[model samples]
Target chain A: MTKTLAIDCMGGDYGPSVIIPAAISALQQHSDLKIYLVGPQQELQQHLKQSPDFGNRLHIQDACEVIGMSEKPSTALRRKPNSSMRKSLELVRDGHADACVSSGNTGALMALATVLLGTLPGIERPAITAELPNRKGTVTNMLDLGANIDASAEQLTSFAIMGHVFSQLADDVEHPRVALLNIGEEAVKGRDSIKLASDILSNQSQIDYVGYIEANQIYDGNVDVIVCDGFTGNNVLKACEGITRFLYDQLKTEFTSNWWSKAVSAMVWPILRRFQRRINPDQYNGASLLGLREIVIKSHGSADSKATLFAINKAITEIERQVPQAIQDQVAQLLLNTDNEDEE
Target chain B: MTKTLAIDCMGGDYGPSVIIPAAISALQQHSDLKIYLVGPQQELQQHLKQSPDFGNRLHIQDACEVIGMSEKPSTALRRKPNSSMRKSLELVRDGHADACVSSGNTGALMALATVLLGTLPGIERPAITAELPNRKGTVTNMLDLGANIDASAEQLTSFAIMGHVFSQLADDVEHPRVALLNIGEEAVKGRDSIKLASDILSNQSQIDYVGYIEANQIYDGNVDVIVCDGFTGNNVLKACEGITRFLYDQLKTEFTSNWWSKAVSAMVWPILRRFQRRINPDQYNGASLLGLREIVIKSHGSADSKATLFAINKAITEIERQVPQAIQDQVAQLLLNTDNEDEE
Candidate 1:
C-alpha cells in the first residue's frame, strides 16, 4: 500500500535545508511513499536534489506565509492561513495526504489541527502523545503532553484510552499495560481527577488497567501506557530532557578534566558513542497528535535531518495502521458505551 | 552555636543500622553538633559503636512505636503518636533539638511535622524543597514537591517567596533568580493559577522574579529557584530520577556488549567513577520541609549511611542559618505586606 505524507518545509530551526534532505532520503528509502513539500515553492525547489523520483513522488505545495516559533495560536490561526504548518494540515484534512509531519510551533499546530480536522467522536480534545525509550529497550507511550493543562477526570480517561490504542499500534505490544501517572502507587495518592479516572478505568473491560504508576517507574518498561494531565506530563517530559543534557555535560567535563582522563576518554570513545546511539532522541523523535480526525506528527523543533527522517517514518507507520480510526473505534466501544451504561 | 538534631533511628530502608553509623560519623565530623537517637531504646543502643562522644553529645530518646513506610498519614498520625517520626518532630517543637532529620515515610513525616511544629507566619502549608545539581556546578532549589497537589495561586505565590529565601540561605545566591515552572516561557502559556501566581510574584519587592521558565531549561543553571505546584514538581523530580537510572543502565549495557567494549570500559573505569561521583545523589540527599515554624529534613527513604549523613548536615545547616526564622521574616515582609497594600 502507498502512504502519502504532507511535510512542512518552512518549519524547525534549519528549515528546508534539513527537511529537504530528510524528505529526499525518506523517498529513497521507501519507494511506495509520496511526500508533498508545503512551503515557499521557489525556495523548496532550489534545495531539492535532482532525482528520477522527484517529479514522480515528491511535489511542492506553495505556502507564502510562515508562522513564527513564538506566535500565539489564536493569532497564527487568524493571520497565517497560508503558513507551511497550516497548509500541511490542510493537505491531510482535504484527503490529499494520509498524514502530516511538521516541526512547527506546537501550540499553533494543535489549535490549527483541532479547528481544521476536529477530533474523534468521543474525544472532546486532542492530546500530544510521544514514546519514551524505556529500560527494557521498548517504548512507553505517554499522552496529554501540554495539550490540556488542567484535564478533568473524563479527559484523563480519554487520554488513557488513546494511549492504550497507540501503544498497540505503535509499539506492537500485545496487551499494553496501562497506568495512571501519579506521585505514588497507592490508591489514595494523586489529585481527585486521577483517582476518579482510575475508578472509571478500572471498570473498563477493554483497557488493561494496572492502577497508578509514579514517574520513577515510567522508564522501568513494566507499563506500556502512562496517562496524566498535560501539566504534569509536559513538566515530567521536559525534566527528563534537562537531566539527560545535564548528565551528558557532566560526562564530557569529567572525561576532559585532566590530561590522563582525556587520553582515556579518547581510547574509550567508541563505547561511549555506542552508548549515546542507544539512547539518542533522534531514534524516537515524533509526537503524534492523538484523537485528531487526521494523523499529525510533531517533530522536535531542533531536530536534525536524521531526526526528521524518524518523524517521517512515524507518520508512515500511523498511516499504515490507521491510528486515528483505531482510536475512534476503541473510544466509541469503551467510553461512549460506558457513558450509556452509567446513565442506565 | 551548638546545633542539636533529633534523628529518627527507626526510619528508612536500613533503619538503625544505617542511621546509627551516619550519626556516629556526623558526631565525629562536627564536635559541637549533638544528636538524639529517637526510636526503641534497646534496638537503637545495640547498633551503636564504642565512642567517647556517645555520652557527651549523642543521647537516646526512647520512642516505642514505628511508622510503616506505606501507612496512611492520617492512620499514622492517630494510631502511632509515639512513632519515631512523631517523636523526632516533637523534640524540635519542645526545644529539645534545634532541628530534626528523618528518613521516614514522607507523607507521615510531613503531616506530623506540620501538626507538631506548625506553619510559619503568613504560610498556610509547608512545601518540600530540594537542591538539584545544575550544569554550573551550583544547585537549583525547586519547591512544593508533593506537599499540596492542587496548589492555588496564593499557595504558589507562597512557594516562590519561601523558595527565594531558601535559595539565598542554602545556595548562598544573593538576590536569587526565581521562575515559575511552566510548559512554555510565553505569558499566555500556563494555567490561570500559574498566571495569577506570576502576577503576584512579579509585584513582590523582595522576590527577584525572572518570569517563566520551561522544565527543559531547569538544569541549565540559569535560574536559582523554580516554583511550581506540588503535583508538577513531584512528577518532574521523579522523572529526573527515572531518566538518570535509565541512562546509567543503558551505559552499562553498552559497555558490556562485547569483549572489545568491555576491555575499553575497564580501561576508562576511573574516569567513569569520577563522573558517577560528581552526579551522585548522596552528595545531595536531603529535601527540606520549608515554610514550617521549625526545621525538619527528610532524607531519601532508600538512602545509605553516606546519604543519611548529608541529610543530617542539611538539618544542621538550616538550624545554624535559622531557615524557618528567615522564611517567617520574608513571608511577613512580602506576603503580609502585599496583602495590606492590596487592601489599602
Candidate 2:
C-alpha cells in the first residue's frame, strides 16, 4: 500500500518555501510515498509548480487559516477551525493519511493530536520524542520534549514504555535501554516523582530499564532512551541548541579572522560539512508525538527545505513501520496486567 | 590588608597536583595575595616542597578528613569533624581568611557555607552564580546553579539581586541588567513562583531588572544576570556542557582523520586557540556562593591548574570588592522597606 503523509504546508517560519519543496523532494525520492499538502491551496500549488512533473503524486487539501507562532495553543485550536495544522491532523484521524507533520506551535499540535486521534490505551499522556545524535552513529531518543510540563509518576512510566516501543520500531534498537533522567545515577537522588517513577519502571519486565542517568551522562550514549518531564527536556534541548549556536559563532569568528586561519578553514570545509550533517538540528528535523493512534511529526518552525523534507521522510518511515499498531498492542497488554493486579 | 584565600587543597579529583600548582601560580602573578592551604599538612607540605619560595606565602592547616564526591552531604558534615571543606569555610567565618575556594562536593560546600557564614539578614537562601560566556567578549552571571532546588518567590527576588551584584563585581558592569529565566517571554507564561518573582523584581527600585528571558535568549548577551531555581540552572549548565563537548569531539574528528584536514587544522590552530580562549570554562572557573557572610568560589571538580588558579583569583576579586558587604547592605534595606510597609 502507498503511504500518504499529510503535510501542514502553512506551518513554520518559511512555510511554503520550505514545506512545499520538501514534500515534493521526498515524494520524488520515495516512489511508494504520497503527500497530501494541507494549506492555502493556491499558495501551495504555486510553490509546487516550480518542481518538475510532480503533480500526480502530490495532492492538496485546502486550509484557509494558519496558526501564528505566538498564538496561545488552546485558543488558536478552538477558534481557528480551518487551520492548516488542524486540517493536517484531521487527515490522520479520518485515515485519509497515514501520518501528519507540522512545524507550527508545538502545544497546539499536541492538543489537537490528543483531542483528535486520542491517546493509546493505558497511556495517560502522549510524549514528544526527539532524536539526539550521540558519538556513536546511532541516535538516542529523548521523550516528553515539551509535551507535558507537569508529569506524574504514572505518566512518566507510560512515557518510558512508549519510548521503548518507538525506539525498537523507529530506530530498530532491540531491547532498548530506557533510563530516567535524574540529577544522579543513584535511584534515591531525585525528586519524589522521579523516585516513584524509577520504582515503577524497575518493576516492569517489558523494558530494559537502566537505573538512572544524570544530565552530564547524556552525551555518553549509555542509554537508548532518556525520559523526563517536558520542562526539563525542553530546557535541555534549548540549552544544547544555544550552546551549539554559541560554538558555531565562536568558530566562525576564528576562521574568518586571519590569513593562515582562512587557509586552514578552506581545507577543513568538507570535513566540517560532514560533521554538520551528523549533529545539525535540521538533520533530525521531526520529533514524534508518540502514544497517539496516528503518527504526528513536529518539525522546527524555522526549518528550511532540508529540514522539512526530513520531517516528511520521518512521517513516511512511521507509517511504513506501523508504529502506532505496535504501541497499541504493547499498551493493551500493560492495561490487561494492571487490571489483573487490581482484581487480585 | 593583604587578601588571604583559603584553598580546600583536598577537594578536587587530582587534589594537590592541581590546587597547589594553581595557588603557586596565583601567588606568582599577585604577590600581594597570601594563601592559606587547608588540608593534611604532610600531603600539602610535600606538594609545597616542589615549588621554590612557597614557604614565605603559604600556610598549611592540618585537616585530616576529606569529603568524598559521592558521600551523603548531610551526613558528611555531622560526621566528619576537621574535614578540609569545613575547615576551609571556617577560616572565612572566623575572619582568618578573606575568602574561600573549593572544588569539593557542591552540596557539602553550600551546606557548610550556610551553617558557618549564615545568609544575609533578608536573604532566605544562598544562591550559586556561574559565569556564562556570551557571543560577545563579555560574560553573563547565571544563578542559583544548584544551591537550592526549590526556591520561593522571595528567594528568587533575592537571587536576582545577588546575581546582579555578582555580575557587577565580577564583570565590572556599571548597571547590570537582571532577568528571570522563564519558559516564555510573556509575563503570564511561567509558574506562580516565577510570576510572583517577576512582579517583585519589576517593582524593586534598587536593581536594574529586565523582563523575562527565554532559554533561547540566554546567549544573546542582552542580560548581565540570569536567575532561576537550582534545578533548572544545574540542568542548563550540564546540558550546555554536554553539547559543547559533543561539538568539540565532532570538530576534532573532522580535523584529524585526513592529511588535507590535518593541514587545515594546523593552519587554523591560532584562530581556534583564540576562539577557545574566549569560551574557555577555565577563564570563568569560579562560581560565587552568594548571600554568605564571606566570599566562597566553587571550582569545578574536574578543573586543571589553569581553572584552579582562575577560581583563586576570583576569590581575591570578591574579597577586594567587598561583595558580601554590598549584598548585606542591599538586603537589609529591602527588609526594612518590607517592615515599613507592614507597619502602614
Candidate 3:
C-alpha cells in the first residue's frame, strides 16, 4: 500500500526551498508515502535539517546539474544529462519510484520523460493533462498543455483516448464525455485537422465522443474531458490564468477605492477569498504527461509549498489508480481496431 | 463631422429584434450620425414604427437573404449574394457609408469584407481585430482572431503593423507598444513562424515592437497591442471570454447557496453588479477586420442590442479616425522601403 514519488528538488523558480517543504508536508499527510528528493545533496540538506525525522521518511538522490526554467529542452537533455529532472524521471522509468513530479522547464521535462519512459503502444506523443475548475463544481480534464503543437488527427484521437482514461481515475467519473476544443461547436466549423480527428473519434463506439465544444464553453463543465493540440491548449490555459488574476486584481483595486467600499469589502472578504481560492491556478498544480509508459506529473514552475503539496497528492492518486496500465489497455484496443480496419 | 454606418440588421442570433433597438440607441447617442439598415424592409418598418421620426436618421436598404450563424464562408458567399451582410459591405465599398458593421457568421463576414474592401497594399490578409479589457483602464487590441489561420511570418509582421495603426486610432495612444503572442516571453522560444515574425518586428524602427508576450501577461496591460496568428488569437479570445463568464456564474451560485449567503449578497449586490458590468464581454463587442481597404467591423453572432450598439459606436470611432487610410499609408511606406532595398 506504499506509494513512492521522485521529486525534482532543483526544478522551478524556488527550487529546493519550495520542493523540500512541500515534500515534507506531503509525507505528513500521506501515511504510506515515501519521497526521493532528487537534487544537489547540499542544497536539499539545508532545508532537510528544518524538520524532525525528515531524513527518516525522506531519501536523497544526488544530481549535479540543474536545468534552468527557460533552457531549451534539446540543450538541457544534451548538457544536463545528470540533471535533477532527468534523475527523477529515471527513477520512475526504472520502477524505483511509482511516479515522478517535477516543476522544471516544461519542454525539458517532456523531452526527458519521452526518452526515459517512451510512450504508450499506440500513442505517438504523450499529452500534458491537467484538471481545471469549472462552473458545475466538478473538474474537467484538458490535454496537451504545451507539449506538442500541431498534433495530427491521429495524435488528437490518441489524446481523447488518453484523457478519457485519465478522467476515470482523476475525476472518478464513469463514461467520461469527451469533446474537441474548437472555435465553434458546429461540426462543419474549424480546420481540416480537427474535422479529420472528429471523424476518427466518432467511429469509436466505446468513446463517448460528444462532438465539438468551443473554447467559450470550456468551463461550462458539460464534458469531463476536453482535447486540443498544444498550441490552442497552451493559449487557452494561459488566457484563463491571465483573466483569473485580472478579476481578483480588479476587486482589490475596487475595494480600496473608498471607506464605504472598504467597509463592504470587510463584510464580504471571507466569501470573496473562498471564491478566489476555488479558482486559483495554483490549487490545480499537477499536469500529468498522459500516454507515457510511466506516470509523470508536471508541477507549476512557480508553485509554492501548498501548490507543490497538491501536485504530490495528484501523483499519489495517479499511482493508486495505476494510470499507465489503464491507458495501455485502452490504447492497445484502439490500435488493434485501427489495424483491423486498415487490413480490410 | 457626420458619419454614416451600414448595419447588417438580419445578422446574429436575435436578428432584427436586437439590431433595430441597438441602432436606434446608437443614433440617439450620436446626434450627427446616419444609419443605413440593410435587411428586409418589413422587419425595419415594424421596429421603426415605435420611434418618433425614425425615418429621419435611419434609412432602409432591402436584402432578401441572410447567412446563417454557422454557415461556411464560401457557401454563404456563393448562395447568399444578396445577403444583408454582403449589402452592408457593399455600402462601404461604394462610399455610401463611412463604415459597415455585421453580426453575421465570422467566416462569412471576413470573406465578404475581404472581397468587397480588398486588402491594403503589402497586406496579405485582413485580420479580425478586437479590443479587450485589461488590468489598466485602457484596452489592448488583438488581431487575426480567426480571420485567417496558419499565418506566415510575413503576414504576422503585417498584423503587427496593422495593429499598431489601429491602436493609434482606436485607443488614441501614440507610439503604441506591440508584442507577439507566444507560449513563452523569452526571445528564443516559440515556433519558427513566430520567431521569424519577432525578428522582423524588432527590426522595424517605426513599429515600437516590444519583442514577445506570453498568454499569462495578456491581461497585465503591459502592451498596447497583442498580435498572433488567427488560430491562437481566436482561442485566446474565447478562453478569456469563457473565464470571465465562468467567474461571474460561480459568484452568482455562491451568493445564492444559503439564506445567510443570500443576506450577504443583498448587501454586496450593487458592488458585485458593477464589477460584472465592467468585465462584461458585451461591452467590448465590435471586432474590426483590419488590413482591409475600408472599415468593416464584425459583431458577435450572439450579441444583444447593447453589444450591437457598442459595435455601431466602434464603427463611428473608426470612421472619425479614418483607420483604413492610416494603415494604408503606413503599409505603403514599408513596402516602398522594401522595394528600394531590393533594388540596392
Per the 3 Å backbone cut-off, how many clashing residue pairs does candidate 2 have? 0
- Each candidate: chain B TM-score: 0.96, 0.95, 0.95
The 10-residue segment with the lowest total lDDT in model 1 chain B: B47-56
Show model 1 residue runs off by greater than 4 Å: A49-53, A336-344, B49-53, B336-344
**Every model: iRMSD:** 1.1, 1.9, 1.3
* Model 2 C-alpha lDDT per residue in residues B1-344, reported as the tens digit of each score: 68888999988789988999999999999878888899999999898776868555778889999998877678667999889999998988888899999998888898888998898877888999988888776888899888887688888988987887677777889999999887667654666898898887776667788888878767878899998888778888887777777788778888787887887777766776787677777788888999988899999988999999889988888888899998888668766664565456
DockQ of 1: 0.77
* Full ranking by DockQ: 1, 3, 2
List the candidates' TM-scores in order: 0.96, 0.94, 0.97
Interface quality of candidate 2 as DockQ = 0.57
In model 3, residue pairs whose N, Cα or C atoms come closer than 3 Å (at least 3 residues apart or on different chains), thus clashing, are: none
Model 3 has fnat of 0.66
**Each prediction's fraction of true contacts recovered:** 0.83, 0.56, 0.66
Candidates 1 and 3 compared: the better one by DockQ is 1
| Model 1 Cα lDDT, one tens digit per residue, A1-344 | 88999999888899999998999899989989999999999998788745455666989999999998878899879998799999999999999999999998889999999999999998988999999989887899998887888899989999998998889888888899999998888887778999999998888678899999989998999999999988889889888887888898888888888998888888778887877788787888999999999999999989999999999999999988999998888888888767766676
Ranking by TM-score: 3, 1, 2
Regions of model 2 farther than 4 Å from truth = A49-56, A334-344, B53-56, B203-206, B334-344
Chain A: TM-score in each candidate?
Answer: 0.96, 0.95, 0.97
* lDDT of residue B290 for candidate 1: 95
lDDT (tens digit, per residue) of candidate 2 on A1-344: 88888889888889888888888788779888878999998988788676777555778999999987767777766899999999999998888889999998887898889998998877888999999888776889999888887688888888888888888888889989999887656543657888898887776566788888877778778789999988778877887887888788778778777787777777767876787777788889899999888899999888899888888888888888898999999778865664465456
